[model samples]
Target: DTAVSQTPKYLVTQMGNDKSIKCEQNLGHDTMYWYKQDSKKFLKIMFSYNNKELIINETVPNRFSPKSPDKAHLNLHINSLELGDSAVYFCASSLVRGGNNEQFFGPGTRLTVL
Candidate 1:
């Protein structure tokens, strides 16, 4: 069974479009995170939610937000998408225990803004 999963393995949209990526985890982890990998392969944390509460909010644009309806799901919503928003978005989940946060990453959603 896949621990973490994300929808729309690839997404292509024009600028100024709004889109969303759905993520789900079956590992029963209480903490989940969203990351963005740019063309340079630099990974940056976009947001992190613990127990369905927003914990780490990175310095991303206001247009990006992580919506967690429950502990098992955290979806990313992007509004007024720009060219800079094009990147591979990854969803991860981890069980935080005793400072051990071995995150399980999803296949990733490659978003291409045209």
Candidate 2:
């Protein structure tokens, strides 16, 4: 079974459109994060949650939003998509116990804005 999974592995849309990516983790983790990998392969954390509570929110554009309905699910919604928004978005979860920071990442959703 996949530890973490994301829906719609590939998403292609035009600029100004809105889209969402769903993510779920079966690892019983308390912390989760939304990461964006740019073309240069630089991974940056967009949002972080612990037990469904917003913890760390990076300085990403306001158009990017992270919603956590529960402890096991965290979804990302993007409004007014732009060409610069194209990247591989990854959902990750971790059992933040005793400072153990091993994160399990989903397969990733590649979003391309034309």
Off by over 4 Å in 1: none
TM-score to native of every candidate shown: 0.95, 0.94
RMSD of each: 1.2, 1.3
Quote model 1's TM-score.
0.95
lDDT digits (tens) for residues 1-114 of candidate 2: 999999989999999999999999998998999999999999999898886578655579889888988999999999999999999999999999764899999999999999
List residue ranges in candidate 2 displaced over 4 A: none
- Ten consecutive residues with minimal summed lDDT in candidate 1? 50-59
Best by TM-score: 1
Q: What TM-score number comes out for model 2? A: 0.94
